[model samples]
Every structure is written in C-alpha cells, then in structure tokens.
Target: MLVALRKIIRHFKGDEDGVALVEVAMVTPFVLLLAAGVFEFSNMLNTRMLLDAGVKDAARYMARCSSDWDTCSGYAKNLAVNGAISGGSARVTGWTTGEVTVSKSLSTPAIDSGTGTELYLSSTANVDVVQVSTSYPYAGVGFWSYLGFGQISLSVFHQERVLGW
Candidate 1:
C-alpha cells in the first residue's frame, strides 16, 4: 500500500494537471479586480446619468416659469436626487437660477441643452453612499483596506435652459 501511494504521489508531482492550478493562481487576482472595477464604474455612471436627467427636468420646469409648486426648482432638485436612488438619502446642495450669456455667434441653442435662450438653470448635488468598511471582515483574508480603495463618493452637475421666450 505504501509503495502504491508513493507512486500516485510521484505521478501527480510530474503530471500536467498542476498547470491549471498555477494558471488560475496567476489570473485570479486580475479577474477579481476587473470585476470589482466594472461594478464600481457602472454604479457611478448610472448615478451620473440619472442626475443629469433630473437636472434637465428641473431646468425645464424653471424655464416654463412653472409655479405648480410640485414643478418648481426645489421640486426638481428633490426629484433628481430621489429618482436616482430609490430608497437612499440624497441632499441637494445648491439650486440656483442665473442669467447665462448667450453667445451671438451661435444660432438658436437646443432647449434641453441647459443653455436657455435667455437664462440657464443649474443644479448641483452630492451623494454619500454607505459602504461597508473592509477592515474587520476581510482582515483575516489578507486583503488590506489601508490603500484608500474602499469608499466611493458620488457627485452630479445638471443644467438646462427653457426654450420658451
């Protein structure tokens, strides 16, 4: 039995099956990093797109001089943030209407482009997403979080101008 076991071990030692193990070891980290980056990047992009839509919608209401209370700039800001994150908490940092200079060289600017024919409305929002600290959970796994690679901050800038005269 001992001789048979020794032969089995020797066979595995020289076998090509171990090559797969080595390849996996070499590529696993890269694959994991790519996955994590994709997840993070997608989340950020989705948030930005949502914010841009919100800001444009808000600007639209402002351009119309809508006084429907539900369609005001404040409402637009709230809509922009809440729509992006369904159940998350988001705060509107600033919602201001300003007179943007329209360059004479340019023809009639598009309405939804945020540069209105006469005025422009801009909205800025910052969002904080609660990310779990990887300190205690993954510490035993030898992955360190001291590299400043854990947290994510989200910000958005949206602008629009009304098409109405």
Candidate 2:
C-alpha cells in the first residue's frame, strides 16, 4: 500500500495540466479592470467634447446676438443645454438650463505698463466678451464607479467677443 501511494504522489507532482487555467484565472481580473478603465475614460472624453461644442455654439450666439431681443441670456442658456435657440434634445443626459452659466465681462488689450501703455478699459475702448459654461456629471456605464473610481464631471466653457453692438 505504501509503495502504491508513493507512485500516485509522484505522478501528481509531475502533472501540469491545470497550469494554464490557473494563470488565466489570475490574469483575467486585471485585464478586465484595464478594459473598464479604458471604456470609462473614452466615454468621459467624448462627452466632454460634446459639451465643449455646445458651449462654443452658445457663446458665439450670444456674441452676435441682437440687443433688441428679449431674454438673450435665457436663449443662450437654452442653446447651451439643448443645442437650439428655441429648445431641443440635450447634448447629453440629465442636462438643464440651471447647469449652464452665462456672463459678460470686459476685456482689454495687452498693455506694457513699463512703456507707459495705458492698462485700463475706458467706456469705448474695451471689448465685451460673452462667456458660456457648464458642468455635467458623468453618468457612466457604472463599471468604473463600482470599482471605487468615484464620479467624474465634465466641465466646459467658451468665450466670444460681444459683437452685437
């Protein structure tokens, strides 16, 4: 009986049938993690680009908008969120006018104070710029968040000279 048991142990020790299976099992989780990370990153970047386009369109609209029009800011907000002046489907999910921000600020040309160049914006000397911005939370496929990657928000903004004057 002892000699028979030793023969069985020797045969089992030399067996390599399950080595590949063990290796695959060990590597699969890491590979899957890498794949998920790639997917999430790509999705986030795509959505960010879309948001950038939307903001740019809105800013340009505001810059050339007519002063006679009522609710210009409102129109710009709608354009940024819905990609249309009147209204339309959002560029991404769960977007709203509240998430879009519009503002106007004065910009002056570069001045060399050392050369005695004036560094101020007089009433008629400064350029008026309109800015459109938004921050959208990423609603990913959840694979990334489930792995404790947390949430990512895509923020975009665009500025254009107010030329409606």
Candidate 3:
C-alpha cells in the first residue's frame, strides 16, 4: 500500500496537463481588467468629443443670432442637452436644462475667466460675445466602478462673437 501511494504521488507531481489551465487562470483576471479599462476610457473620450462638438455648434448658432436672445437661448439649450439642432438627439443620458448655460455680455473678461477657456471666443472690435456651456457626469462602467473609482465630471464651453443680424 505504501509503494502504491508513493507511485500515485510521483505521478501527480510529474503531470503537466494542467499547466496551461493554471497559466490561463492566472492571466485571465488581468486581461479582463485591461479590456474593461480600455472600453471605459474609450466611452468617456467619445462622450467628451461629442460634448465639445455640440457646444461649439451651439455657441456658433447663438453667436449668429445674439440679437434674438430668446431664440438663441432655446437653440443653445436644445443643442447642449440633445447634441442636435432639434430635440431628441441626446447622445449622453441624464442631461438636464440646468446643465446647459447660455449667456451674453459685452465684456470679454467674463467669457475668458470661465470654465472651458480653451474654446473662448476671439475678441473682435465692438462685437458682443455669446458663451454656451454644458456639463456631464461620467460614471465609470464595468471594472472601473468596481475598483472604487467615482464618477468624473466633464464640461465643455464655447464662445463666439455675435454677428449682427
């Protein structure tokens, strides 16, 4: 019985059939985490780009119609929330009117000293400025959320000189 037990132990120790399975098991978690990170990052980046494009379009539209405050406000609000000229084109979820801000002023300083300064309007001689801004909360998906990383706040702002109607 002792000799049989020793032979069984030696056979089990020399077996290589489970090596691939062990390696895969060890690497699977890291691969899954990497894939999840890439997916979440890509989604966040796409959302930001969409917000930027929408904000710029909204700003330009408002600037062209600065004289009509009501129209500009409505158009900007719709564009910010929906990412389209008309309604019902919202690319990101959980957007609200409060997240979109539209304002006009003669002073360029106000526009310069606001969030999203990278898209600030160029100063023109005697032209009014219109600024449009939108904010979004990006909650990480998949493994990101599971790792205790919280939501990220993103915003886009664009300013353009009002073209007299």
Candidate 4:
C-alpha cells in the first residue's frame, strides 16, 4: 500500500501533460486585467488633454476680449466646448453645456491684500492681472465606474497679465 501511494505521488509530480494549461489558466486573468488598465489609463489621458486644450483656448479668447464679465464668460464657455468637440469624436455622454463654468478673477499675487472685491479686466480697479478659469465634470468611463472611481472633476485656469486693451 505504501509503495503504491509513493508511485502515485511521483507520477502526479512528474506529469507535464497539463502543466502548460494550468500555467495559462493562472496567467490569463492577470494579463486581461493589465490590458484593461492600459485602456482605461489611455482614455483618461486623452480626455484630460482635450479638456486642458479647451480651457487654454477659452482663456486666450477671454484675455483678448474687452467685454463685460458676463459676456466674456459666455464666450469662454462656448470656446471651451468647441475646443473639446473639435478634439475627437469621443464625447462625455453625461456632460452638458451647463456643466461648463467660467470665471474671471484677479491674480493671487495681485490680490495679496485680500481686501475689498477682486477686479476683473472690465472693472476699472487697476486690473494688472486677470485669470480665466473653466471647470468641467468628467463622469469617467464604464470601466472606471465599475472600479468605483466614479466621477472626476477637472478644472483649468489661465492667468495673463492684462495686456493693454
């Protein structure tokens, strides 16, 4: 009985017939997960780049405008959306026009006093510096949602020395 048991154990340990199959079974899931992670990361990078480009374009437009804050804000939003739309066919399905927000404010260094209201370029308060900021909500992709990452809020702001208008 002992000899038979030893022979069985040796046979099982030396058997190579199904070894490859077992190795593949163990490694396949990890390889698939790695591929999925790469895809998700690339998608996120592309989306962020598009959003940043949009914000930068909008900021440049706002810097050159001598219009009221409200009007400039509208223009900035439009420019940002258009920029994002132009980047690629991939669109954030949950995103909307209302999701984009534009704001104008004095530069932080210039507002060191932290006293009184910050001035926009349209205001006559010796506006030496102005910053244009835009924010958008990135609802993330299905994979991200599955991983419980949920939504990621993204914002971009540009500051330009108020060039002589």
Candidate 5:
C-alpha cells in the first residue's frame, strides 16, 4: 500500500495534465481585473450621457418658466436619483435675463416698425460630484496620499432661451 501511494504521489508530481489549469489560475486574476475595468468605464460613460440629457431637460423646463431655481434644483436632484444624472447635490447658477432686439414685424407693411423686444432668460444647474472623501472608504494606510486618492468634482450646465408667454 505504501509503495502504491508513493507511486501515485510521484505520478502526480510528474504529471502535466493540469498545466493549462495552472496557467489559467495565474492569468485569471488579471483577466478579471481588466473586465471589471471595462465595466467601470462603461458605467462612467453612461453616467456622463445621463448627466447631459438631464441638464438639457432641466434647461427646457427652465425656459418655459414652469420651473424656478428651487424647481430646477429639485428636478436635477431627482434626475440624479433616477440615473438621469450623477453626483450628489445640485445648485442653481448663472441665472440671467436678456432682451432680444429685432426689426420688422407682421404689423409693418412696407415700413419699418422699429425694433421688437423679446425676453431671453436662462439658468444653470450644478451638481456636486461624489467626492472620494464620501465615496471611497479610506484605509488606515498612508499609501492613499501617495496614490492621490482624493477629492474629485464634476458638474453639468444647462441653458435655454425663454419664450414669451
């Protein structure tokens, strides 16, 4: 029995049947990391697209005056929650109004009716990006500083021309 067991052990030691499996085990971790990176990249890209669309939608809402700073902010916030946009918080900024000047109108018949006035208004929403301080749980290692795992910020801008009501 001892002789048979020693033979079996020697056979396994010299066997190359599982060489491919050994190689696979060596490479599997790298392959999995690459796949995970690709998935993360796709997610980031999708988030960016959603952010753009949300900004444009909020801009349209603002143009109609159906939404104000608070409403726009709320809409942006909801969008973030709904995956229409990403980040943490939304803020209203770059709110402005301008007057449009144009000459000639339907009322003018072969005559100059002077300049026509129209109101132009726009607003922007800013979203606070997920900060590393909030998102990434820091380990007790000082290597985080060397790795530059720190603050990150991102925001979106939206603008639209207001239509005269």
Candidate 6:
C-alpha cells in the first residue's frame, strides 16, 4: 500500500497535463471574490456620488429661495430625492422623500432667529450653513451578506454657505 501511494504521488508530480486546470480550480474562487468586490465597490461609489450631488443641489436650491421655510424645505427634499423640485424618478431605488432632511442655520446672514417665519431655524448647531442630508440603505446584488458584510447605509450631507435672497 505504501509503494502504491508513492507511485500515485510521483505520477501526479510529473503529470503536467491538467496543471493549468488545477491552478484555475484552486484560484477561481479568490478571483471571483475579487471581481465581486470590485463590482460592489463601484456600485457603492456610484450611489455615494448620486447622494452628494443630490444634497448639493438641494442645498443650492434652499439657499437661494426666500420662500416659506417649510415649503422650501419640502421642495428641497423633493429635489434631493427626485432631482427635480416638481417631480421625477428617484436617483436611487427605494429612496423616498422621508430619507431627505433639509435644515438651516440660525446665525447665518447675520439675521435674528426671531425675525420672521421665513428663517425658521432647523439646526442651531450648523449655524451659518444650509444643510441637506439623507441616509439610504444600499441594496447591493446581495453578495455583501454572502461575504459576511450584512448591510451598508450610505449617509451623506452637503452644507452650503447661507446666501438667502
């Protein structure tokens, strides 16, 4: 039995016929995992970019509008979610107006908080800044959980200098 096992081992050592196949079989899972990682990373990057752009756009819109604070904030949230103040398709799947948060600073424009309803402050901590933020749960191709990375939430915000009209 020992001699037979040695013969099998020696045969395998000299047999180069399936060497490439064996190497590929050994490395395929790792290569596949690498590819999946790249794909998932790209998706996350794209989602993050969309979130940033949306928040920035919303902040810009909010900064210029001198309308009612609640109304303006609503429009800003709509714009952030739909890319249009009026209405449009959401930038990301499962994204809604609920995820969007539009807020204003209290000390910006050197105005008093008691001035009027037009400047109803939403965040005193972010004074001198107009903030648009959102938190979206990233819905990947489900490979993240398979890889033991349960879930990911893309939380993003953009602040703009207060320049209200």
Q: What lDDT does model 2 reach?
A: 0.81
- Provide the TM-score for each candidate, comma-separated: 0.47, 0.78, 0.75, 0.68, 0.42, 0.82
70-110 per-residue lDDT for model 2 (tens digits): 47888888888788889588887888889989888866443
- Candidate 2 ranges beyond 4 A from true positions: 1-9, 68-70, 107-124
Q: Against the true structure, candidate 1 has what lDDT?
A: 0.42
lDDT of 4 at 16: 83
lDDT score, candidate 6, position 65: 82
Candidate 1, residue 64: Cα displacement in angstroms equals: 1.1
CA displacement after TM-score superposition, residue 149 of candidate 1 (Å): 4.0
State the displacement of the C-alpha of residue 115, model 5, in Å, after optimal TM-score superposition: 26
lDDT of each: 0.42, 0.81, 0.76, 0.64, 0.41, 0.82
Using lDDT as the measure, name the better of candidate 1 and candidate 2.
2
Consecutive 10-residue window with the lowest summed lDDT within model 5: 95-104
Per residue, candidate 6 scores C-alpha lDDT tens digits across 111-155 of 354764443344443346788899988877577687578678899
Top-TM-score structure, candidate number = 6
Error of 4 at 98 (Å): 2.4
Off by over 4 Å in 6: 108-128
Residue 124 of model 1 has an lDDT of: 25
Sorted by TM-score (best first), the order is: 6, 2, 3, 4, 1, 5
Tens digits of per-residue lDDT for model 1, 77-137: 4444444313434423222222111111123332334553423233422211111111111
**Pick by TM-score: 2 or 3, better one:** 2
| Model 4 agreement with the true structure over 1-165: per-residue lDDT tens digits | 999999999989967898899999999989988898888778777777777766677677767778776777676666666643234332444444465655544433433356755434344434654555545666655665776787777776666665534
Give the 10-residue window scoring lowest on summed lDDT in candidate 6.
Answer: 117-126
Task: Please give the clash total of every predicted structure, in order.
Answer: 2, 0, 0, 0, 0, 0
Show pairs that collide, candidate 2: none
